[model samples]
Target: MKNPFARSSRNGDDGPSEIYGYRIYMVALSATWASAMYGYDSAFIGGTLELPAFKTSFGLNENDSTSLSSNVVSMFQAGAFFGAICGFFFAEYFGRKPVILGSGVIFAIGAAIQLVGKISALYVGRIFTGLGIGSHSFSDFGSITASTRTFRAQAQHSGEFRPRWLASKNQIVKAQKNLAWVRHLPVDHSYVVNELAEIQAAVCQELELSGEQRTLVQILHECAAPGVRNRILIAVMLMLLQNLTGINAINYYSPTIFRSIGFTGTSVGLLATGVYGIVKMATTAVFMIWIVDRFGRRGPLLVGAVGAGVAMFYLAIYSQLSDSFDRVPPSNSGSQAAVAMIYIYAIFYGFSWNGIPWIFASEVLPTRVRTIGMMCAVCMQWLAQFIIVYSLPYMVASIKYGTFYFFGSCTVVALVFAYLFVPETKGVSMEDMGVLFGPDVSILAVKAQENYQEFRRSTAMAATEAQQEKQGGLHVENA
Candidate 1:
């Protein structure tokens, strides 16, 4: 049987097909939401730590501040690290949805513990939150992979139908040709020529048809074979991109960022931090609704890096100027400027980097490897987070505002990496993506369309040969 969706190769081979847009959007949206939660959990602590009750209760001091901060902040990353490590095994064993749900429960529990005012308990909460984020990250990637695979399968099935449909239409044309043959029966050569021309035209139309629909038809005919290798590559690239963004650094050190922007008073700083969390959550909600679908993944990422870099540079400059002037209390104008920069940073970071990386990471891998790949990527991110959280205060104190310069520099590096490597996957389906990006598969999904066309041709040729053989058998039977 001929697959309708397969496209014809130049050498007459059939290939995979493309997917529709709506299906891609639905999968990406669901996967991106998981990332939003990831962002929320990572950033929520920033504001809470700024609360005076939090400070006095913990007996924080300048000398022990960094250690205390690291102790509190690092737990989540530590949990995340372990979670990601464990996620690989669970995702592989249980599938994506269950892992995501499990993560959500962990995150909710962590948030509940923090809300209850137990400083020690907060660490336990952070661990659970981290675990959830890590596990969910893997699950999300798996979901996208599954979605892409489905799209590819659909396209392939569509390709298989094209040839059969065209063949059915040709049956009508062939009937016309037979009638013409009978009408010109007295004119032997003329009747034969006309009949052949009609058959040829029908054949040509079948051969010429190509596109995603065509490839789907071919795959259907071929029994919907899986495109395995392409799925792995997509997962790997997603993992790399998620870590390369440096999102972890920003999430881990948002409070330090608030302080650098002139909110040095612990009370004011913590309040601002909580506000930053609200902004992150709010912005992520907006992104899930409006931006993720409209702009594609790379646009928000580039915009975010630029925004973060500029804010960091401003903070760095302000730090240097304040230190150089021996300004114990900043001038009102200077203070206002710092506050404004911090807010801007918060808004920008919230909108772009907070939710997008998780979304991209989750949707890029296939079901089979989604868990392992997500785990690897999330672990790398947490490790990066651990470095930033553990060392940020020391760097800030030693270098003063110069620390901002370093972070700013890192932002530029992340931006460059994003532009060069990230692909726009806003509306790509899971299954079709498998064929589109599979190892040695064509990146141009149109190739699947071509594959579909080729399959149709083969099916037609086979059907024709079968018909001839059947006719020969019938003649033999009659004799």
Candidate 2:
């Protein structure tokens, strides 16, 4: 009873070890680009919304400003909600690649609409952009999840299983014992009894499968790979948290915030907002390539949260100082300090919290549910954005600068959330993600790895048996 699934010892050395590789980096880079587009679309409106050309053309007035802003922001989010709903269907049907490409096209179209609409003050253009962004966000989530899952699956399939050199002797002994057991199994037992015993043994020795059983083992492994499912849950949770950070308030209200800081000119404020977008893009790129892989997810999140909180606190203080200056008619120095603090706030925001959260949201989820989860996450995020953007002007007008303190407090909460819940996934393979999250996290990933091992063993054993048959044939010919 020779084992048909076992491979020769030589075949065991063909796989590679786990370390960061070029292909994996490339995938991450592509996903990062998708996230950048999301940031661009999201933040661009904040600057452009304030242009007199935009305002007058759109029939915007100070009286209805908050409502108008809310409508615009919320519409984008509303479109996103529908897009996420669509992602669940598309991701399952079309696979990851097509959905992502489609998303990009949709997003680009949305941006294009905004660009065209800006000229005519047509609300239709803004709505079109919102539709694209919403749809694209859904596709982006699916793509990132699929890409990560594929990487993990490939890694597990081609990964080396390097048992210790000292363990080779033990392996040999174990092989001998296994062979002995195969030989001793009763060949003349009652057929039914023997069959029943074999079934029981197969169930018991689930991890140590036989050569003929290798196919089943491989199937099981494929089912267990980590990236196969649960991505949606993680994506949704993370995205929801990102929205809760209140960064959208800053994005949607940048012009007003600048004005409050003493930048009286509309053109200056708009220019500053554009500069903010550039800073966000540049800083996100740096974080993705150098910082994300180095510091891990939690560190940046915490650092960003704390830094944002401090900045917002300064904003609140600056607001109060300006009010005092107005009352007391203080020197120009106080005004200058207030203005500098606002710019400082923007810089800190661009560097720390704004872009990084979106990246984090993209990376953490498992493959099967990634698109659905991302859509859910982003939907909640946009909805939150809508609320904050819509409410901020009124809050500022009614409560003065006290709204800054509220946002700063929320940043502290975001910090705590990141520290407690978010795992560091910096360099971990997608296949191994199940192990990191928990044993039950990724059934597909775990199963996939197991199946691959079983398939390898089965193929090896089959080859060995074929070689042995050929040798026997040669011996018979000589006789």
Candidate 3:
């Protein structure tokens, strides 16, 4: 059979390719390890802090232990905030691969330092680790998704794309191989020819409209462009909302949350918390693989907000009615119900809010300023995370069951945010995002996708005809 991407005398029209496919998963799995590492490190502290041995080893049970534990738990996030800023400069100077490699090395150094078994040393280690993780996270999450989507989308429209981080010959060659892998074809294939032509046309059209600017200062200014600015707003809000949902409260202080609900003994609380992790892992897998692209980002976020809010509301009401005013209640049917509610909340969270924010941020920004914009957004995310992590212990102590109410109210507001601000990005090309979120977008309009897609196709066709005529004239002259 003729290659689907080829013209083959059939008028070069195969329509737009599928927005997502197996190739995306293959590329994502192979490339996005920093995301997984970040999750592993973040979750490790939750169960670790609960360990009696760990407490003894770190002298965490000594005087002012509560404050100490909070510090230990929160220090990483503090460091991550600064690390995100460092990431912007690192990417600016060194490019993407060096950032990845440097982040890994720094994380390893921090991990090794933690193994020395001294609390003072661990504190220093955690900061370095946080720095590494924070630096790695912005580049890893932003580049893999944005670069992949932008590359593929541009590939579908233009054919060949020069990567932003082609610092050397080796990097350029690697990028070409990666692109070929994403296309699931040999580099020299006729399918590649058509794709390259289309991509070039799109690039040409874009160039005619704006001059290229490569300076870091200029790119930083580009971050203020209306389309980029709006996306940055969306990304920051989504990330802030993500933490405000209180996922970190559950993650970092699960034993405390579990104990507050009903479960007695560290083992019981940890066991229940272990179950929460299992459920999260399972459901997150389902969402990441199946629901995200199929169901779209906005819908799941809306459903997750309402469902999680309801679960938290149940927990709050249960705690209020069934428990003592000053301390945690004993294990009863209501506490059991609260435990179940926690599980339910996890289900809602795992299916949507957990993963969608990163995806949204990755797709929303323009390629030139994507890393800087994401660095700013990820900094906000870490700041939000730090606030929740550092403050939750105090909030739970002061307000008791009222903490759930606080989180629940936040989720309710999140519902409004998703409905009003979150755009459905499924199947939309990166090139089209500016137009999608452009000033002309009407808040009342239900679907702007079809209208804008038709416009892009018409423009692409005109650019393609111009390219073909140029190539034809060159061929005749050479002959």
Candidate 4:
């Protein structure tokens, strides 16, 4: 079978060799640990906070324990929210590679501090970990000393992508060279030159459209501009709706809920959780690799949201009818269906809400404000998560079935938001994003755009070849 990675998806581009594909995959594998770790750390930390020794060490009684536990677990998200904003400004000044390294340092220090086994240590550690995770993050929950071998190697391998994004302040000056470096082409290669021009045009067009100075304040100001503000709002809303999908509710609540549904033993609950995670991972990989580019983002999002919403609604209805908060013997069809719905939610959420918002946010923004704009979007994401996590317990306790209904409702809203607001970015160019959002571009238009650009480049290349031959003949006649 032919390797997909070896071929270019974009028109007028090629040479994405197997080695390049492998390297790109490694970078994603290493640096994109934040999303996975968010779940891992929350689950582990919830257990940690519940440990008797941990409570005693913190000098907490039951009354204060719940409050303190909420605070401890939520501190990470709070830090992550601010960390994203800080990382953006930091990334702007320092560059991509440095911010990435700094995030590791912060996360490592945070992870190490938590081992001190004090409440203070936990607070600081989680905050730092959150900061690390705010940017170029790989969340390693294991021992930091041992990490020097494994995660460090991953980080080093991930660093190979540095040239592709490191030059922030001087992006234009270095764009051609960076493009050539990644594409494994000479700077003069037509492919590299053409892609570089697209990038440059994108940057220039954004600047011209905004007519704003390239400062942190000015960029934020530009975001308030009519066109930019609406896109930013869309990104924020998509991210917000993503968290509202009851995915995290399951992340934090599933053990208890699953046990309630007759998976009562610790081992059984863990096994159930493991399977859920596996399902999410598998489906998400499928969606990202096979579905995303082929079918486009909107269709999968609508489909997944509907599936998840249906699952949530089913659980809500079952929770009401079965009254199965207390564990029963593992023999009821209704209870099993409730339990299965959680996995079903994971499958749907994993494929859609789990990944699409981030992709949409990144793709919709232009280079001028992409860093800070992403900062805002990511901040909104973490803040939404923190809000959901902190409020979820009370919500589950107070509303019970309505909790699922709330998430289910959000999914319905997400469907409408996607249909009306989210433009298909599948074939859109960065430079044309303004137009795509403003005038509304079609998914099919990307092919036309690519064809036109290819023709334009081919014409330029042909003219250059003819001119070079003429010059060569003139030099020979003079000689």
Candidate that would win on lDDT? 3
Looking at candidate 3, the ten consecutive residues that score lowest on lDDT are 2-11
Clashes of 4: 0
Better of 2 and 3 by TM-score: 3
Q: Which of candidates 2 and 4 is the stronger one according to lDDT?
A: 4
What is the alpha-carbon lDDT of model 1 when measured against the actual structure?
Answer: 0.58
Overlapping backbone residue pairs in candidate 1 total 64
By lDDT, rank the candidates, best first.
3, 4, 1, 2
**Order of quality (TM-score):** 3, 4, 2, 1
Instruction: Write out the backbone clash pairs for model 4.
Output: none
Q: Higher TM-score: candidate 1 or 2?
A: 2
Per-residue lDDT tens digits for candidate 2, residues 263-360, read 66778877866776566556655654445556766577777777767777877887786674234324477666655555565555555555555555
Model with the higher lDDT, candidate 1 or 3: 3
Better of 3 and 4 by TM-score: 3
Displacement of the residue 313 alpha carbon in candidate 2, Å: 0.7
Pick the winner on lDDT between candidates 2 and 3.
3
Model 4 lDDT tens row, 421-450: 776666454445666554333323344345
Q: How does model 4 score by TM-score? A: 0.78
Can you give the TM-score per candidate against the true fold? 0.60, 0.63, 0.82, 0.78
Q: Which ten residues in a row have the lowest lDDT in candidate 4?
A: 138-147
Q: lDDT of model 3 at residue 400?
A: 84
